[model samples]
Target: MTKPSIVFLHGSGTNADIFRLQTRKLAALLQPHFTLLYPDAPYPSGPGPGVLPFFEGCDPFATWMDDSSAAAEDAYWSLEDDDSGAARLLESVERLVREEGGGGELVGVVGFSMGAKVGMEVVRRLEGREDAGGGGVKVVVCVCGTVPYRGGGDVAREEGGRRMLGRGVVRVQSVHLMGETDPWRAEGEKLVGYFGEEGRKVMWFKGGHHMPAEDAVNKQVARIMLAACGKV
Candidate 1:
């Protein structure tokens, strides 16, 4: 049997480089049983000094999009092009899986921070049959991502709830790592609520926003993810 493929998506601001340590550790332990792919985010470093764009209106160390109107336009364009960085990420995963001969049965996605949001969109798109060949995502692992941005008000309600149905109810297991003191902890909890069971798990760390401070936390989270992938 082919090893399971685990795609790792970085959070905003930070690039795939940040995952080098975790990937290396996991690969050492899970190799011959799992394949790992770490893809960079879609935003470019801004002209300003010391800036990484990962999302609009939010910049946490690195970002996936900019908050400006022009940045929003760029983001929309990037998302539509499919050839944008995000598309390249999807393509890279597909290519790696094919090269490894892993087939589609063992494919899964793991997204951190902004990447988690991107992972959700990928699941939504794949579930919608938006891909060229009509493939579905087997499992999604969201580390610390927010609920996909719904418009607002009733529109947001309708979009968030109704849009998920299009994906046909695939297995979605969410792992929220949050610090009780972290400002985003509440938001992370809210995101977990959206999973509505189906193997949802939350792990809290004593520290602030950066909870996975030690190898123990990483290993624990990896174990949860592996189980979610049915690898354990």
Candidate 2:
């Protein structure tokens, strides 16, 4: 049988190559069971956080959207519903799935940081348009993720105009890896909350805002991914 495909999306200001290096350990464990696909974002960007020194030579970075500091701050405060970039990303993933999946199933998505947000947004969009035969993503693995930019439309608010929690739950089995001391831990938690609790597994690592480097953690994460892929 043709192996299923899993799309791996890189964070903002990073390219597919850097994401491959970051998730090498986890990919090593999953490669036997799945075909992994990494695609670069459309917009050029400066180096993202944690890309200094070691990954300095790996320049020519990219981002899914206009991730300027000012724009990001404004979006966060205004709850802007701009999803054009995420839509373009979905187009890229669909093309990659058609070209690179080799007639195999498009199974899951593993994304990091901004990639995580973009990936989930794409998945959520697919969920709405999927047919009864079920071609939507089966699982999602988010590392240091953030909430989507209102792809499902403006989120419902409470009487006081406070955004309602669990209003736009993603109906997919998900694995979220959060860094214990990461600056964006809260955002990661919010991302987890967006997924259905029954199928969501949130794991925390000791490090901050990076992929899990420990052998044990990698193995554990791999096992969960295997289960998601129905390999174990």
Name the top TM-score candidate. Answer: 2
Can you write out model 2's per-residue Cα lDDT over 114-177, one digit (the tens) per residue? 8887777778767766745456588999999966542322332221123423335678899999
| lDDT at 59, model 2 | 83
Please give the lDDT score at residue 131 for candidate 2. 44
Q: TM per model?
A: 0.66, 0.85
Write down the worst ten-residue block by lDDT for model 2. Answer: 152-161
All candidates' lDDT scores?
A: 0.57, 0.78
